[model samples]
Target chain A: MTKVTFIEHNGTVRNVEVDDGLSLMEAAVNNLVPGIDGDCGGACACATCHVHIDAAWLDKLPPMEAMENSMLEFAGGRNESSRLGCQIKLSPALDGIVVRTPLGQH
Target chain B: MSRCPSASTLEAAPIVSETVIIVGAGQAAGQAVASLRQEGFDGRIVLVGAEPVLPYQRPPLSKAFLAGTLPLERLFLKPPAFYEQARVDTLLGVAVTELDATRRQVRLDDGRELAFDHLLLATGGRARRLDCPGADHPRLHYLRTVADVDGIRAALRPGARLVLIGGGYVGLEIAAVAAKLGLAVTVLEAAPTVLARVTCPAVARFFESVHRQAGVTIRCATTVTGIEGDASLARVVTGDGERIDADLVIAGIGLLPNVKLAQAAGLVCDNGIVVDEECRTSAPGIFSAGDCTQHPNAIYDSRLRLESVHNAIEQGKTAAAAMCGKARPYRQVPWFWSDQYDLKLQTAGLNRGYDQVVMRGSTDSRSFAAFYLRDGRLLAVDAVNRPVEFMVAKALIANRTVIAPERLADELIVAKDLAG
Candidate 1:
């Protein structure tokens, strides 16, 4: 299990143990963590599951693909650290990864 | 602006102990409940659904779930504790039989009455069935509910013959899964081409070729006349005097909005329940959203009834905000997607009135985007396995950008650069 933390728009931090091989979006959704809608169910189609990876852990995670980058362009409040939670898979190597969700994704 | 649910306001109203009752438990209804709580509406929220289970995602019903790649429990949008934690009272296994508009109350099938200060009609829609002889046979089926897919799953045996009535997305998606599962699948479409009503002929032909290459037989302009069989086996008769024996038959014609209850309550319904930009129905203190709503799309500049999860979720949020006294227009750019085999077809914007079609990338390579242009203005785009192009096209369509046809047709130019 990997320990992940999700910070909401209002600075509400939620820490949960996510299983390996599960995406960050699924971890948030299964644990009832608000702000990550995952409307398309991790298909990488809808960008509702937008997130901002903490700067410290950015290099530790895999690079963003072209599809995810394009989808994030439509996401509100997108920045250089912006990444789609659905495209980020959980693993033991990324145990203490921290991410922040945007205020809205439309 | 008249504070009485007018169409011109973008502000939230003051909240009280008002009870907001949402009818229909689907993606839209689920979003409505979530948005209400997210917006800090402490009022009571009662969700009434006909299905026994909580709200689940429907897109997987014909794809992953059918292929046995996804479990039934995973399809649920949220766990059971979600409603309890969110303070949402759910009425499952019972449907609202009657709606008394004046009283702001709905009568349940079990003779229970629930009154509310505001009501949300998200009744969704039902699958259109085959209106032919033997259509009621025990071997025939229509996919809409979990039970329907379960029944079809049991019949999808290896080497078993499966006949799909329509060649729409649902039918094609199911055919892809059925073929992958070792079933001999055949699709019969009444239109001249599969997906004729939704996509351009070029895109339709592309899909047809993809399905044919997968060993699925597709016959266009051929209507299923009748289904002749009992409990054991069946034969699907066609208009051209040909018959194909099958172990199971599924109808994927289309969906019809569940507007009988809304109509009975004297609500204005055209193709669907008519609502304004704020998702307000003709009646005050009442609103409608999701597949059951026909609202004006500002981007399209016309009223359209979209049966997509994006539309449902977006409209549900708009209705919930309006109920909380925050009236914002529902002007979301309509988008939809479908996954068949290894191809992911992503469509952005509505291509209703297109005058020219520009092909970007290589169609032979099966990775391209079809740009619909109306007098040099981007209208819509159908991107197959090309997500970047589809995403850029959405921005172009939303901005109503006009581009030279040569730039769009040039595969050498990057999607972002072309849009820029």
Candidate 2:
């Protein structure tokens, strides 16, 4: 299992150990993390699972697909580090990945 | 702005001795449990569900679950440990046989009685079954629960003849999955076109064409008269006297809201359990959410009973707040989506009572949005692979924004800029 740190907007930090092959959204949701909604069940349909990865870990993740990019265009508070949690799968290379949830989700 | 009480305020408040009994453990029931805890309701939470397993998402049951791409565990909204950690008392595979509103208690099928200070009726709907002859045939199926989808998946073999009784989202989604699995799929719709109840004819035509391109046969204006055949084969007889042979049949006609318990309890019900904006039922201390409640929509100036996941989740949260004395009104534009083949159809707001439709972009490109307007005001939008338009249109509809048809149809005008 890889360790993932979810930093909420209020600065509340939660460290969770997620199994490989599960997406970051699943890790947060399964662990009862508050911010990430994952309303569409990780279909990349809903943008409620928006998150921002640390700049240092940006290149470690997979490139954003066309659908994820288009959907993120309307996500609230999106930026350069913004990515859909459902689109990024966990792997051993990204052992201690950190993602910050936005102040609010769409 | 109405804000929830801070964590410190909730902690400082009196210890809650009240118990909240939530009936019908589905999407709304699951969310209610989470919301109650998140809102710092340190009370007893009992979730009663007829289904044996924990609450799972039903949308994937028709798409990814049927396609064999998403596993069963992934369909669950939350893990088992989360429920335990949340301290939720769950009664799975048990039905609420009686609801005594005056006494503020419910009788379970297992002869157990539970009293509650607050009652949440999240009892959702069931798939509407066919009333014609042989409707209960062993070969016929309806996709509503995990068991239903599992049955269909087990029968989904390559080259199998599959007949769909309705051309709605569920049936069409199954048709897409079955066709992709190399099955001979046929869709029969009773209306003049597919998705007639939900979308306009133009959008329906686009979806129908896409399904046709995928080699799925769609027959509209056709009604099934009966079902016949034995173990080896199943035949569907239509009103046109055509007997369509099928290895199995799936029906996605519609859903009938489960309101028997609410009705028996003497709560007002009109098509669905009648509720106010706060999701409170006719009875005091009793609230209802999800597909079973007919609540008012301030935006539309009408009552609506929505079956979308968005409504279920939002209403569940709203109901929880009301139970906690937060009492915020529930009002939001409804939205729904469908996945067929490689296309994604996202809809925002209701297109009902629309006076005109403005088409943005060319449908031939397979990426366009249809804007529904009434008296030059935005009412709703049906976007096919147009995520930006869908998102902007949702906001525009909520704000009752009025945009000219020419400006809406112009391809040069960016979707976001239309808000100006």
DockQ (C-alpha based) per candidate is 0.53, 0.69
Q: Best candidate per lDDT, number?
A: 2
Return the lDDT, model 1, position A18: 70
Ten contiguous residues minimizing lDDT sum, candidate 2 chain B: B1-10
Model 1 has an lDDT value of 0.88
Native contacts retained, all candidates in order: 0.48, 0.48
> Which numbered prediction scores highest in TM-score against the true structure?
2
Model 1: which residue pairs collide?
B11-B326, B12-B325, B12-B326, B13-B325
- Residue-wise C-alpha lDDT for candidate 2, range B278-347, written one tens digit per residue: 8999998899999999999999899998888989988999999888777678889898888988888899
lDDT per residue (tens digit) for residues B45-133 in model 1: 99999998898889999999988888877787776878998889999888999999988899999999999888999999999978888
**TM-scores vs. true structure, each candidate:** 0.94, 0.97
- Predicted candidate 2 versus true structure: per-residue lDDT over A1-106, tens digit per residue: 9999999999999999988889999998888788888887887777889999999899998899888998888888889999999999999988899999998786
Q: Which ten residues in a row have the lowest lDDT in candidate 2 chain A?
A: A39-48
